[model samples]
Target: MISLEEFKRSFKVALWFMFLTFPLLVIKVNPIERTVLWKWENMAFVGIGAFILSVLIRAFFIQKERSRNSSKNKRRFGYIGDEPLVQFILREPKYLYPLSGGVLIFALLFPALFDTYQTNIMTTALMYVVLGLGLNIVVGLAGLLDLGYVAFYLVGAYSYALLNYHFDIGFWMALPIGAMLAALFGIVLGFPVLRLRGDYLAIVTLGFGEIIRLVMENWNAFSHGPSGISNIPRPGFFGMDLSLDSAILYIYYLVVALVIITIFVVNRLQDSRLGRAWIALREDEIACQAMGIDKTKTKLTAFALGATWAGLVGVIFAAKTTFINPASFTFLESAIILSIVVLGGMGSILGVIFGALVLILLPEYLRVFSEYRMLAFGGILVVMMVFRPQGLIANVRRTYQFKKSTKGGDS
Candidate 1:
């Protein structure tokens, strides 16, 4: 039997979801027909069903989790190995080459393992992974909040789009050039907002992103306005005449390679002197400055590096879609990337990768819950903030901090 408090909690959740469902149900625009339709009854069913399911799942899962955690805690001493070597191999990062190799093999063959629809989804997921990593450098490592990171992505896409259209630059040849342009733009944006932090910094970056998108949308001569540039060249190797399947497989492999490279680079950077400096800066700007780290130089390099990653993704995105448009690079894109970083565990290598895959793929898989996506997202953010503000998977450093803080608590 449920208690009064439990009933109250569930009732409030139901009310919130009911409120959320009203908007999605009452308004629907059919893109093909260019018509609006209202379906209040349909939405009402969806909302009421969701509320019931959520309450049931929450009540059931909460008790189950408590029991599972309790049992595991009690059984831990009996299961865990006493041997130091066994423990070291299990815990240490350096001993995980075999695991990494298996994952790499699986990723390289991912396209062949699934149908076109699924493979396309995987590709999209990896692209966001790349974007998340790029933003990780700024927000995760440097402790900066950037809301206009999509500007760099836009720059990269348009750079490749224009170069390929006019100069006949191949995808391979134009990729680096596009990334460089984005890095340059990053520096341009970085200079003006060097002193700002938190909300002020976010607003400036958001505005900068909007400005880039608006320019692309209105600049009819260069970007061709809303029509977008088409027939963008795809990446290929050594003049190979490839079929559609082969071409897609090739692209998948290439992205996997890039993801591997990104993982390696980010991991190395996270362990390097520069990464430590970024963390210090993130912890406290004044404190880092007092330690003799040049504020301007360090911050600019962080921005440029982060933007370069986004720029690379932009080039790949243009190639993947075979077109470019201002609509593709919006503030929402920036928000999603940032969300990936935050959800994954900022400053945690494994966290970012897992975060990207979960956030991207979960939505794709939850198509049945399409109308409730935003509602679910809002709930997730709120829950994470209240329960595990550190993230889904906290970095070891952050985990240690949590433990240390709790150790001194009166309770």
Candidate 2:
């Protein structure tokens, strides 16, 4: 129920939006003809849209406040894990299993249903899924903020590009080599930041990423300068010659397989001994170390393992595009990967997967809105942060309860 005051507020918001968007949305200039055209209808559209949105947003906030107050008085509150819809489904195995099966089936058949362009977009999204999961290990579970994760990504990409260009190493051979090289670089990065935490650690990682990019950009002979490396080959299937379409399909399936493997490993890691150490370290480094967890080894392992996935995807990215450039692995790329992890529930695999799809595919589909796409993107992100900062799904920890035996004997 919107009162007079709410309506007045909404009107004010609408007027502000109209003013802000007037030059861009409601006016056009023909510089060659020296004429200016004003589309008054656009102003009306903006005003109405903004008014409705503002009203709905305010209503939501009101309801949320009421709910928060009520929840405070409730003895047992709802478990705030997955988003409401996701939680509703996941709370029941009957719903969860069927949904998971349906999704897997859809993924397997996606290439068959869509064209190469769509398949390519999905491949890119899946690549980010792996990257997000990788960074999740460091930033999410391990609670180590890494702003330069793309350094390892750069290493993996350049490793394959350089190796293939000079040594004629194929994609298959370069995959493991790229991964190991990235791990080595991760260790190199880890050793220096062993004592740093929070903002200081983030700064070091950011500097490390910049350093890698600078070296790649300036080293003309080694990295081909700004021109970048081209003609990188895609992954092959048993030395078989495949058509462009066949190759695209093959890569799609390959990434799907990789995503599956990654999810499996990450899920298992969440329940393993090392995973607990990482979680404890995330909560409190001082307490975790005091409890006999080796801080040095834990941090190093987080960096190394997290980077391995980036390396893996980096190789695939180089192969997919058949081109490698320093510009492709910028700080922006790292930020986007981090955003995916953050937008998804930090330590949740399913959340990362969904976040990757939403973030990557949404932009591609919004090409029709070209000029306004980023505007919409930023608005959506702002709303998400304000409303649900925990992400699409919150990472839920496994809990156990002890039950006493009937006779008071140990059970």
Candidate 3:
């Protein structure tokens, strides 16, 4: 029976063996030609191979070490504290909040530092941050898995597009209508699936997304089928339309303001009783019921609130892209948003923002890799999961520290 430390050291040695072998296999063997692969293909191949080998070695050695330690402890009756320690660290919001605010402010003010393409990418990333935060409320806070989230986004975009196109409505006027419609749809969907749990709920929501897309495709009279709506109106500020003449700075500020509003609303909700109810439900539904929380209303609120965020973002997305179709709101889009929530750490507001940025922007920056982009992206996700499964920013419990009260002094 080997000790844990010895097992880990042996695992590292094995990993090193595989790590040093993969490159040799790729280069010395010459089994695959570099010209046939993408510009970054060789690098990606090495990375992925190393990652797979590392995961296997770690799993094998860790399990072996655990079993060996268990047997030794059983024979000797020695105590080994295997339980994880749970601790909380308290920090002032004054410092944390201001730092986050400053980062956003810099992004708004320094649009010129990024090229036009990068600005466009940032805009897309911001849209996801909003969408991810919205989903966070339902999936993270409330523990409801939604696969039809994109339906709300599509509804919002098309709502504004059709209304503005036919009725000549302004962007601002159309936003609320889009959101309300999406919320209505959310409630409608929520009713039927109230009793369903886990995979069943996810399947139903996935079907709902498909239904919406099918309608968009086959119902050409209304949605234009494959062609989709184009020339959607852009948002205006103070009666001035934002167009090519409107600098990226204007758009950056506009998105920044929206993100701030979103963060403020989400933070407020998280501090409220409703947020507590959601968290309780997430931890255990039966327990939440025992505590007098209405599970139905809680779940519905989560759906409606999450849908509203998607709708609002849809309006902004429609305005920004200026054209959209059924193709944009696919299952993959839903998965990406969900990934952001998971990667960011569930129930964390700032974590979602950081997750969306990394997951969305990092791949775009690696566009130079072209064919290997997705491979690299997937590789990064796998690595992140293995190393930091809790998320990039694990949830930290906040506690307030104040001076202890001193009893009144004697005369």
lDDT of each: 0.84, 0.90, 0.80
TM-score leaderboard ranking: 2, 1, 3
Model 1 scores worst on lDDT over the 10 consecutive residues at 77-86
Model 3 CA deviation exceeding 4 Å by range:
1-90, 245-248, 398-411
* Displacement of the residue 24 alpha carbon in candidate 2, Å: 14
TM-scores for all predictions = 0.79, 0.86, 0.78
Tens digits of lDDT, candidate 1, 1-411: 446777677777777777787777778889999998887777677767876887786777776675456643353333344333433443556877777778888887777678888888898899889989999999999988999999999999998999988988988888899889999999999999999999999999999999999999999998999889998877877877666776777777777878888988988897778998999999999999999999999899999999998989899989888888889988888988888889888977777888899999999999999999888887887877876677766665422223464555322
260 in model 2: Cα distance from truth in Å?
Answer: 0.4
Can you list the residue pairs that collide in candidate 2?
A: none
RMSD of 3: 8.3
Instruction: Please state every model's RMSD to the true fold in angstroms.
Output: 7.9, 4.5, 8.3
Top-down lDDT ranking: 2, 1, 3
Displacement of residue 18 (Cα, Å) in model 2 is 8.9
